[model samples]
Target: MSDLITVEIPLGERSYNVVIGPEALMTVSPLVAEMMQRGRAIIVTDEIVAQHHLAGVKTLLTAQGLTVETITMPPGETSKSFAGLEGVVSRLLDLNVDRNETIIALGGGVIGDLAGFAAAVTKRGVNFIQIPTTLLSQVDSSVGGKTGINTGHGKNFVGAFHQPRMVVADLGLLTTLPDRELLSGYAEIVKAALIDDARLFDSLEKIGVQVFDSRALSQAIAAAVAFKARIVAEDEQERGRRALLNLGHTFGHAFEAEAPKDVIRHGEAVAAGMALAFEYSVQLGVCPAEDAARVIAHLDDIGLPSEAGKLAHTQWDARRLVARMRDDKKNQDGRITLILARGIGNAYIETNVDEEDLVAFLETKLK
Candidate 1:
């Protein structure tokens, strides 16, 4: 059995555990088998991961004596879309997957969100397991149960809070991530460290090891996932504590809005977003200037963007991009709430930003 970290998400009957460990993918049979009221299961992955890892996952499940089917979307953030999700769901129905069946999302965050959304809406609900193959999904997106697809209006505009039955993070997968992709995932851990875990940040800064060390990678994954599990369990519905998880997301999403879609990945935007939020925090007096500099310095140290600023694609569909932030599952009221850092290990919501400030922020950073 994989070493499991159970998160008692307060969604009552919808609660689930997030398992972390070596060879966790093989445990799918018993882990999911116990959760299913039906015998059929479907694996949804992006074509890239499908070509690389789908066979391993499929073989593992089959060896466990579980029946499996696999479907894939192309690689990239854009795949988190209505059309992409429709393809998966359509395939699910065609495969005769039922409400009691399970969906095993075996890729990065994009596939997790798309497949989880399919599970959430399929016959009202279905079990979903997160087999996050990338470092970012292992520690961030895969744990929260927030699933959705992007709209032309913005990113992740359509989705649900459907928790997965289990999450498997294979350190072996991290070994295959590109150097840039690895750094991208590190940005999220950096954001977590800046917000509420200075000790973790300090450790990563002082002793962060490359993926070659299985022990180090496992420790990093466990630590980050444990932190997220605690936050999600406290506020599974994003009513409070969970919002802390968005520390760099606001600025990150905006940076994403200005990008040439896929030219920069989600983690890259998050890296830039962390810097922007830290800058905004210092400017607003919410955080100290020294702290802001430290935040930027750390991201830079990890090869993430500290001053990625923003791209000024004059024709950039700003309104279309900004629209996503407003509707993002993280927003509240008409004002999009942001998790801004006050200092390392301290972050809070700032809803006082006005349109003028936003425009200036966007123009200065994005343009």
Candidate 2:
């Protein structure tokens, strides 16, 4: 195993470490064992991941002299649903999983969110660890304690703030990722930089997609994890500082809800959402148009969905998207809260935004 980079999330009793590096999967057993004394582990993963990584995880845990059980679910955003959540919890119950045992979430964001929520609700909460496989999950979703299942009304509408025991992100696992999935995660990495790290954004812009190269990938993961850890430590429940992490999420979730499901994944919608956010900022006279253009250009250069009009295989309806935003969790008192940028590396929460103004902007974007 190569030297690993560890970012500690300090939350007092709830704090944990995010271990990032190549071949970090090998460290999971020892890490979990250290944090948890004597208990069985239930590995929850998606079917696609099961074919590739399940045996490896089971072998590692078994070698550590820990009993292990595996639960496999179908992969995709759909798995983060109430049905899926119930199924996982029920399976753990059938397995006679004890409160002391840990639930090992061993897949992408979907599996992690599903299993994490299951752990949160089972026996009123059980130990959970994240072994995020995709870049999106590794850098962002895995580190934060925000876990939930999506609802028919909107994304992550029903969930809990369940922190993990630890996060094991093996950058080497990314070598097998499809380019689209890799780019999806890249959007999140860019998101972390755009929120507060101008230098990191500059580095990402310079490297382009080569940020996936071993050294760059490790650095990017460490930086993203560090940024998230700080915010999560300060505002674990997103009452304040942590809301900044949702920079593109409001518009992004709207895009995901309204766009053709297959046409856009979470990261792609977020890439487009970030662009819309900057453009909206420019329209609101808060962010410079040049700054918005720079952000969009970098995203477009990487083949991500940065423009609403350019979204392929999808129909656009600005009114429908506007409606979705109304259902977003970020809204308060019939007013929406958006994370808009003043410029590169500067974003703030803009509340009580007029729906008419948003509708007008969406119309322009669709045009």
Candidate 3:
């Protein structure tokens, strides 16, 4: 095990620590013990993660004299929906969980979102801990308090900014993830660098495929987490600069909405969406064409989905994807909001984007 890295999200009253490294799960028991009032905790996870890490977590908490209950759901994007939220909340209520108790999210992004949202609304609100077992969850979903289930209209359209009391990202758990999953998560890491960290982007470009190497992986995760912590602290409610974090999400979510469940993972969509964002920026003369090409080349080299037409299992329509973007939460006054880059490591929020122009650009990509 390597030395653990702790990144602080300084949100004053809501501030918390995100601990990352191999075997960081060891920190969870003591942290949960401190938050226990009734000495009870509920673990919400998907079946896939439960099979691998659930029993060990239960043993750790029970050793500390805490009563632990678990709610396990199916594994996949479909589980992040109204039905999933209802099932978790209902189970927690049935177990008589109280505000003083804690809810632990123990899986990837889907489990984190579902369980975190459950913690937000149940008993009006309760403290929860994030034990993210996947690379995507460890670097992205687990650190931020943004939690919610998906609606038929779009992804994350119904969610809240409920920060976790603690986030334990055990890198050892990531060793079990498939290569495709690792690649998917790496897209977000690239996104953070593209948003405002040119140095980080440069490092990523040099490291390239070696990012999966342990030391490199740890360093990348720490840098990405630190970047997000700073942005989130400044704009917890996303009133300003924080919107930069959604560099690829607006286009990503639309891809997700049009695709069938589990056909495309969130990170895969973001990878393609990011490529499109840069390409669109180039078309609008806002970003250099060379920068857009570089972004696409990096994504393709990483085996990620870098173009909408290249995304497997779904045939995309430019008009339908544009319609989905209209429902994005970031939009205001019926004008679409997009994150565009002027260059690598320079992304900004662009509002009132011309829909006709967007459709035309997407049409080109489809062809």
| TM-score, cand. 1 | 0.88
- Candidate 2: lDDT over CA atoms? 0.86
Tell me the TM-score of each prediction against the true structure. 0.88, 0.96, 0.96
lDDT of 3 by residue, 106-201 (tens): 999999999999999999998899989889888899887899988767678788989999998888888778888898899899999999898998
lDDT of 2 by residue, 9-85 (tens): 99998788888898787865676765544556788999999988888778877887777788999988888899999
Question: Residue 31 error for model 3, in Å?
Answer: 2.5
- Give lDDT: candidate 3, residue 137: 88
Clashing pairs in 1: 154-324, 310-365
lDDT scores of the candidates, listed in order: 0.75, 0.86, 0.88
Error of 2 at 186 (Å): 0.3
Candidate 2 TM-score versus the reference: 0.96
Model 1 scores worst on lDDT over the 10 consecutive residues at 309-318
